[model samples]
Target: MIKDEIFFKNREVAAYRLLDVLPIQQMKLEDWIVISSSFGGYSIAKIIADTLDAKLDIMFSDKIVAPSNDECDIAIVTEQEEVLIHEELVKCFDISLDYIYEQSKKNYENNILSLINDFRHGNPLENIKYKNVLIVDEGINTGLTMMACIKTAISLGAKSVSVATPILPSASVQTIESIADDLYYVEKLDHFIGIDFYYDTLEEIEFEDIKKINKGLN
Candidate 1:
């Protein structure tokens, strides 16, 4: 939020650069479990999980956008039902805390609950405990969701936590670094546009695709 960061022609350009920071042979695949934030993250996570042939899971997070500015994010709610507040932004924008909490609850009920059952396809989340967990997303604009995911992973007993993504805003990098054991990104910009800005094809991914992708792995 300090300043508008980097811009790319497209997401592929960002992903190509992300290659250097990706966790390849550095960690054992057997000891890793790949989990992703729903919707925006599925494609990136799908590729990573399939390539590594690692067990995959999904976690849902919904952001509370500013009342006036749709592009502005005020906070994030995780599937574990934890809420992360962007204190500075909220204060600067004079967003009501009560409103944030209400939205968080609504998002959890309408989004996260069914996502948990659908993503897991009936399996329990026992594999993440004591494992090197990698949380995937296409990019980090506000960084709130990633932070919540990192914290949730730790609470679930993740021994180490890492993040893999194509892009991250410069403002969010330090915040995410404080929480993630290892943070990886293809590009770090001073600011980022909407998630759709980086892609050519933005599709509404069906939940069934998540089940099919992780099938037989867990």
Candidate 2:
């Protein structure tokens, strides 16, 4: 049973804890890249990337929600046009592939592309071909976003893909393990109460702050 208590005081605290388990010592640093799953993740990713001495980037991606339920994410899509649908959810709802594709295209062009332009000035993602990738997020809820990031990284020739997060739903552990090369997390809860519940000071990162972080990295 998972404990009923806050796991991290803040995202920075979680980042430091994750560094304890990440295999940074074995990595050459130059051969690895750190990618954030969201703008909020940049703070967490910055800490990890600084520790690993690796380049940091953001995965321009978004989730495709079901038509009837906005909370139900049916699939994930990246700016690179990579997609990963939740087959079980789609089947359970009898959702059509045509709808998924349509949503995927819309998400790519509308959401992901906007993020790429805002954060990266519309430049293509850094060359990660043959490089080990470590994807960081403050937390994972459905895991669809992270899964899509893994797929996109692999499709772009990432030699190996790993993930790091502060907390995740216990149910998602096995699925994430099967796809990524490694998973580093502080807590895996049997009953997830939402990512913010586990942190004492989880604030939404501002757009300007994220751009500042990007500039500092460059």
Candidate 3:
């Protein structure tokens, strides 16, 4: 267990630490859209958005039975919401469950390609232009999901895709670097277990609340 003092004192440090690791050049906060799923990720994204003076978009995967890709400059999500994103992809793409299961068996490296191909065939939006896209998550363990997120953004026509996280496992960071144009991580714990270990307040956000936040932003 993390010591209380270490954890509490680190909160403020962790808050601003994200900005230091992020490749600010690729992130024109004013022009990008930020999406977050988990409470931890959303909280951090909110801070980052405020710091960058960018628009924030929030979505609860539980309520979104279908994949609703909105018009935004960037997309950010938490690790837990990845499964929901995949589910939405399945429904939006009209792919068979058998195909999804089979494709999921492959390494995460290829899983990203699957999501992009699925998006291409499923939702074909017009006049979508995202010069820079960034996906923010609380932490990354395998990096596969991040890759998939990056793949989806690039497939949607983002010129450059980047990732930001509060904390990430070293191995996962390496994997993300391979696919992302830029990567930012606040902490690289040697024995990282999960994102929850680093946060004091990890709450569950409701879909209505997310919708409300989105509405206010618009």
Candidate 4:
């Protein structure tokens, strides 16, 4: 990490900063639905959703880590059973497709399902069909998880899928922009150590706090 290179005080500050750069005036805010990628992201997404007076929801996904290195994510699996693989990374690692699929199934059944049940009360996601969708995360590192959310939203019949994040690595911009209808971000860094590195306090959202947040969402 760069010496003392904190960008914002916390996710709330980041979300507010992001709102400054977002193209809000031109968008039909009423037609939009915001979906957060994780509980941590829901904090920022909720602010954006509330500010825009749009509906808010969360998307659940779990990373499929490399067999050799648990910290290395080879792909991501969404609660809806959608898998987004880093094909080149998998090939370079010589990871078997079978292994990836097997891991994805486990991630969905075990991890993703638990999150869905906890945050969403075991109910289905709010209807987003034909609605413009905005996917938000506090920050993005590899963009794999955000990509999974984008793809999942489209598959659920979203009219268009846009993405927003406070911080994003320069390398991921093109790849993410190619799939998303529009992308909004606060800072684009040449090198991002991790999402947590950019913020002073990007702490995990407690389960109890998450339940409270969910209760107020549409």
Name the runs in model 3 displaced over 4 angstroms. Answer: 4-14, 23-30, 37-40, 58-128
Clash count for candidate 3 is: 0
Q: Give the residue spans of candidate 2 off by over 4 A.
A: 1-4, 28-30
Error of 1 at 66 (Å): 4.7
User: Which pairs clash (backbone N, Cα, C closer than 3 Å) in model 1?
Assistant: 5-190, 5-191, 6-189, 6-190, 18-186
TM-score of 3: 0.60
Q: How far is candidate 2 from the true structure (C-alpha RMSD, Å)?
A: 2.1
Candidate 4, superposed: residue stretches over 4 Å from native: 1-4
Q: Candidate 1: lDDT over CA atoms?
A: 0.75
For residues 114-194, write the lDDT of model 2, one tens digit per residue: 877877788999889998999999999888888888889989999999999989999989999998999999889998878
Listed in order, each prediction's TM-score against the native is 0.79, 0.93, 0.60, 0.93
Quote the lDDT for 146 in model 3.
60
Which pairs clash in model 3?
Answer: none
Model 1 bad stretches (over 4 Å): 1-20, 65-72, 93-96, 121-126, 200-218
RMSD of each: 4.3, 2.1, 10.3, 1.7
Q: How many steric clashes between backbone atoms does each model show? A: 5, 0, 0, 0
